[model samples]
Target: AQSPLALRQNILSTLGRTMLEEGVWTFPFTRWIKLIASELSAYRDAAPPDEQQSLRYLTPQDIHEEIKHSGLLRYGDTRTRVEFAHHTYQEFYAALALKNQVDDIEPYVDTPEARRRWQGVIVLLYGITTDRVKLYSQILGYSNDYARIWLAAQCLANAGEDIPTALSRLQEALVPSQQFALLFSVGLACRQLGRYPEALTYLLKAAEENPASAEVQFELGALYRQVDQFERAIFHLEEAIRLRSDFVDVYNQLGLTYYDQEKYEEALTVFRATTQLEPHNPYHYYNVGTVQKILRDYEGARESFRMALKLKPDYIEAKTQLDMLEKALSTGVVQMLEKIPMLSKMTLEQSVLLANRIQVKEYQPGQIVFHMGEMGDTFYIIEVGEVEVLAPEMGRSSGGVINRLGPGNFFGEIALLRAVPRTATIRATKPTRLLAISRDDFSAVLSRYPAIAHRLAETSSLRLLRDRQIGRRVDLDRYYDPGYIAELTRQDRVTVLMGDIHGSTYLTNAIGPELMVAFLDEYLLRMSSIIVQAGGAMDKSLGDSVMGVFGSNPDVPGDESLPVKAALLAALRMREEYVILRDKWKQQSPEFAHSGMGIGISTGKVRTGTVGAEATMVGPAVNMASKLSKLAIKGRTESEVYIDGVTRQLAGDSFATEPLDPAYTKKKVGVELEAYRLIRQK
Candidate 1:
């Protein structure tokens, strides 16, 4: 048997002679056969008689037989045309044909179209050819196109040859403006060649040249990972993510690095976040499930796997994992329930009897397990994961998280014992598993053991009282006077203002939930008052952000400039109020010192109407304001306000402003948005 490389070389030599002679990689079947035969005949005639007999020349019949057996070539769209089975096959042979004819490669590298067509062949030639000096010199001479120069640097690094001299010469040949591209290309090439230390040096230099480049950060992160420097890998990867939040590949690499370090919870968080960013991607869901399984959150893993299978029915790995999870859960439910403290009160025989009556149920994250006011007939015990108890008015999407119950906790007992409606909503904050017992089973158990009923009744009364208190705390109507509901309408143009607290995640982690809630309450109350006083209608309050619209009230008619001025005034007041709030909070805790606010204002046409039962403002202006708010926070350290050019123009000289750097703005905003910083009233 011939080695794979020898066979490949033999096939290339046979077809490459015809390909080079004809100056084409593709040819008609009969034309290809004729060329091959002609080349073979010439070689046969030139050989000595004794050697010629030993050289077995193939006939047309034999050539046709070889085409049928050889897997290296295949027919094109039309059966009459034949070409290499893969483009790489053709590229290798073309490189081989050009090995000695070094001058013939220039036409293929001088222009964008030519480079794209022969890029593979050129790189392959750099690897197999003995005359590296000539190829390197020829490529660098075409300095007019930096793309070609970069390509040559990449080819040299990838060829595993000593490239410091060539790289130095290329860098010297290029202008300063083009140095970053050369450095980045060489660094990435070094990375691909597994030269991590050298790759790091070049990439760090490239990053110094263009610090905000997400591409550079990503390369550095990946290079750091290759060297097992996980912390550095995480730092650069997160920086890349902060620069470009939509970078899914960076998120995956960060999550994988976390997994390698045995930080399963952190990995789960990253993978779960990717799922939110790309919900339709089955692989993201699969990755989330894999990490959740390692964390021992079996129910969460099972739900994630099921979601992956749901998105792609033929996902074999997801299907297999789901099957295995279900089997394990079915076999272990009895043992799992037996370990519960509540069940431990019963005798072993009684425990077995109750466990036999229990059924296992699973819920996905954000899934509503049950709603308030629904008649409940089952008692649930938390077997794994967590669920949130929300008051009726808090609903599903808002700040309704009153209480969270994790593994070994239980709920729904009041409904089961009292035969009444559920007092509050139950939502799974993460994938959750619950062991449920029907009212009938509970009744049967109570009949056998009356003492259990008395204990349940006492627990139910306390829970019912707590639920009422929670309901009262969250009810919006009790705290504010009733206001007129604005009629649903659309406005031709409006000024939309969006603002959010910066460093909210850090604040939440540092001060805990209770204090965070108090902080948000104080922040939103002052901000909303400012917006309303400025003649803007409150649009929505989502977590840490608030959106308000000016010129949206149909009852009031005014000049376009009126709304712009009002929106700007509200933004300025909000920023000033945030400074005071931050100062007061800083006195209480050092963590609040870093906290700030960002506001974005945009003026354009918007549709202000009701969607279902909720009022909304929908338009490019609304989206722009939200994105600008995020950009403001990401771009600055202190509290700042950014307004679109339209708003600035309408405000005229009424407000002092400074235009943002065009390049920096473009990089952060990813659009042609001319934004200005609102300084103060002129």
Candidate 2:
């Protein structure tokens, strides 16, 4: 066809052009030479004589050796060999040209040697690069027998080429069953690149195609763990373990999974087995100690912690545990020594048996030792630390403080009873140390010295009650329990008085409202001060009305005789303050002199809390107080204070009481309830 002469001229021209453009021929490597030669030979072998004449000069043996030297075929694994060949020749070359920045082909792109051997591989296959246009053009020039061509596409996929291109090539090649592995590989690549939501879809498809794949299960488990789907992680990890039990890392992961769920016992068992399986792992021993401490197996915890410390003495977690144990032991020693602080007179061995059971602890600055009102289950003997104690008032509180606790001064002895909360809040002022004593150890101490427990309990209870009263909420339990509230009936007579300033609306409107608010604020504050001074609790304050408790928490220990005294003191204080405030206000406005208070005081039992529409109404105590206050307003009695008969008796003989005639009282439930007016003996 006159092509030998023209072909030689064409080859020379193309080589010159390539060398000028790249400083070397674009495909100058030995592999590239081999690939080009092999592909020519392959075409010759497949063609009949007339077709073969197109490139009949090549030999088959030469092509086979070219394929072998490229390292793609050295393993003889068809998938790997084919994958290497396709990428080295097709996808790689196309990527280099597309990027437009190749300076040194030797490092930047595949060697020409690789290209020579795999050039034929590229011609046979298609679609292994993002540049589909290039691949399609390259495939059109190659021999079109479908099997050789499809094999080439698969080879590119194995070499980590562009996945979308690989998929397109595989689809065109029409070999779905054979391409399942490639699809799975693509899915893993997608996952590593942080395309999880997309990767999941591909992985599921790949798995459906090849359900028995172990690699797939491993990948799925990892993904599930990433998303915190522990249940699914357990399921997949279990399957993986069943398939391969010697997977030590997986066992560690399984143990961590259990730990995260707070299934400590199960976690313990798992970690123990793992440690046995890998004896040198200190982390496993540390985990084992952690679980033991959670179980309250102190001896076992101590032993495990010691093992961890022995393996890794510098471990902070292990050291912390050792500190906790020592503190516990020290507490035991203090309780023991309290009974026999004089034991310094005894022999060392005698003390050793007792001291061996003790534990000591240390706390760092800013650490909360205990919260106020928290159950004190253990006590401490300050071995080498200082702690601060604070008074409990809502915000502004002032009380005594404990600055330093040394070896002899012990605290928290009152916690033996289940009911006691901590008397004061303790916090480390500096790096402090303590000897801790458990209730159990103290009980043992008490068995040996019976009076010590009784003496400690009595002293502690007195201190605790004083602290509670220093600043605390009312303890309703002292006055009445649930049974008392439940048994209380409407017929039970307990009177209460609630009162407010009369003509408050008219006074507010005339006094420019702003001044009225200030007046009411001062009034209520003085009233509340008096009530509290009188040994009564301020119940609740509406905008004007004041509700108070004369005997709510009666059992709160100490000052039991002071409630009536406090109430009377409050009334006197309120009267005194009102005189001054009223005179000042009268100068500012006429409304101050005109405005007066409705005062009512009664003593009778009443049901409390919400009652009517929307359950908002309070019970008869409030209702009777309101009725009595209205009566005081109508009586033209200045600073009117009224008490029923029961209050007269509670107030005792120092006061005088006169029953108001029935005609002076209003009817309620078709009967006139008797009332009284009271005053001090003149």
Candidate 3:
């Protein structure tokens, strides 16, 4: 039996053939009936005389009856025009018609109007067209529109057909600027076709071009998963999630990867997280239930499965799981409590007893669970969602968040251990659920299980020791929100570009402080604008220099070398703009004309975070960039732009560079640094 989708496709394909034969796309219902009748008559006439006599030819009335019954076509409000039930159906049939009649589709795609009208047809054709290489080559030849070209590439990638010839053609025609998109598309195509080695080669190249692309990271992670490279898969998936936190699909894929490795606990955590991200998604709930069932949390599994069913009443898989869970419970199967750090030492009986006394509590976002200085005796373990630990005394009006806790994390342990006031305020950062145990219940379990008490005491003592150590250091929460601080604190590969006005002091003396300040402001403003436009963040502006960092924003999708490229481009633009500015300033004052801007760029890993209440980037690259900027001083070097070896390497063939004399750089910079003179972009 054909599925509904297949049946619809068949019917649409037939209608498309009829439309093509009659050379009409849209028409009145009466005209459509005539076309169908004419097509049926032609088919009967082509048959042998004996067969024609016995053949069942659909008349105009028969065709009209079938069309009405199929519900695949509908009349316009005026009852004059007839069209496909859905636009997609119209596009699907049109593509089939074009594939049947046209040998070369480039002519149709070359014009904007044709491309727009038949855009869906072209994409659909890529999937079913014979000689996809020829088709791709034809489209590539005429289409200069990147979006249109990319659309074709995406179609070819998802065609699920072997495309070695098409891939080779695309590679040969690859434009330097479009390299990332082309490589990524080809890699995706190869991956879909199960050509893992080819897919990896292209995707790796694409990644080098733009490491910040969450899509590329996701594809790489999925590819790694297919190749059974669990660790690599996890790394890429985690990076994808980090690059785009709201990527619910990546979370699900990451969860599935963990499930493949039989790491049920990790899988459960990831799957549960997806539920928080997309609360109404039945699939996420089903995934969570599956992992819970494996981890022997029957009750949790039952709840998850029930939720899935509630979201999608016809979710058969969820219904089956819920039924099975109920049967297991009826048979007296033990549903163990989740293994938390504090409860790890408790025996099954003791854990179950303690679990029964544990009360589940919910909190809305921004709702305080406990206030600082309030006497508290309840310990909390986050069941689902996040909470912020705030310290008002550490000083922000909103209360400084000292730490953030998520699922499986516990706090308020000090209150459980002794009669003390809450050291910090606990507030829900999102819709949160926590498992709470009163001191009496916890103490009862601890009294019955000596080992549990000892283990918890050791853990609590370590936490206290860490807290005391943290107290001695500067309170980071006082300067920035803990969440912002955590986000800012990371080690990452980045490109740092430093630009400084040469002979600024001389200009200051010649122009005077009044004119110098005004000229400097305009100069800095223009330079800063150029840097930002090139996708670099202004780190800071010191006395006569402006510093910018590229690839600092994880949210900005680009290749690995993108930061280098952007930094280099900004440097070139700055020089060009400064030349124009210098010419303009020369008309006003000779002092400003003589002062040239020198730019230095370096690419390497850096530690970025809040320092002394301000965001700062600290690494060898930062130092190298500063030193190189000095080397590029107008009278010191042949060029106004200098870059270190790492930056040059990342810049690749996209930019032109000449190696600086090593001995000369060493003598001037007081370091044995390999440097290059930025010539120009190739």
Each candidate's TM vs. the true structure? 0.38, 0.37, 0.36
Ranking by lDDT: 1, 3, 2
Residue-by-residue lDDT tens digits, candidate 3, 566-616: 899889988877777676666557766667778889887667655477566
RMSD of 2: 18.7
TM for candidate 3 is 0.36
For residues 486-546, write the lDDT of model 1, one tens digit per residue: 3322556778899988788888789654345545645665676577667777765657888
Candidate 1 yields a Cα-based lDDT of 0.72
Between candidates 2 and 3, the TM-score winner: 2
**Model 3: how far residue 592 lies from native, Å:** 99
Q: Which pairs of residues collide in model 1?
A: none
Order of quality (TM-score): 1, 2, 3
* lDDT of residue 380 for candidate 3: 88
Residue-pair clashes per candidate, as listed?
A: 0, 41, 7
Worst 10 residues of 3 by lDDT: 472-481
lDDT agreement with native, every candidate: 0.72, 0.53, 0.71
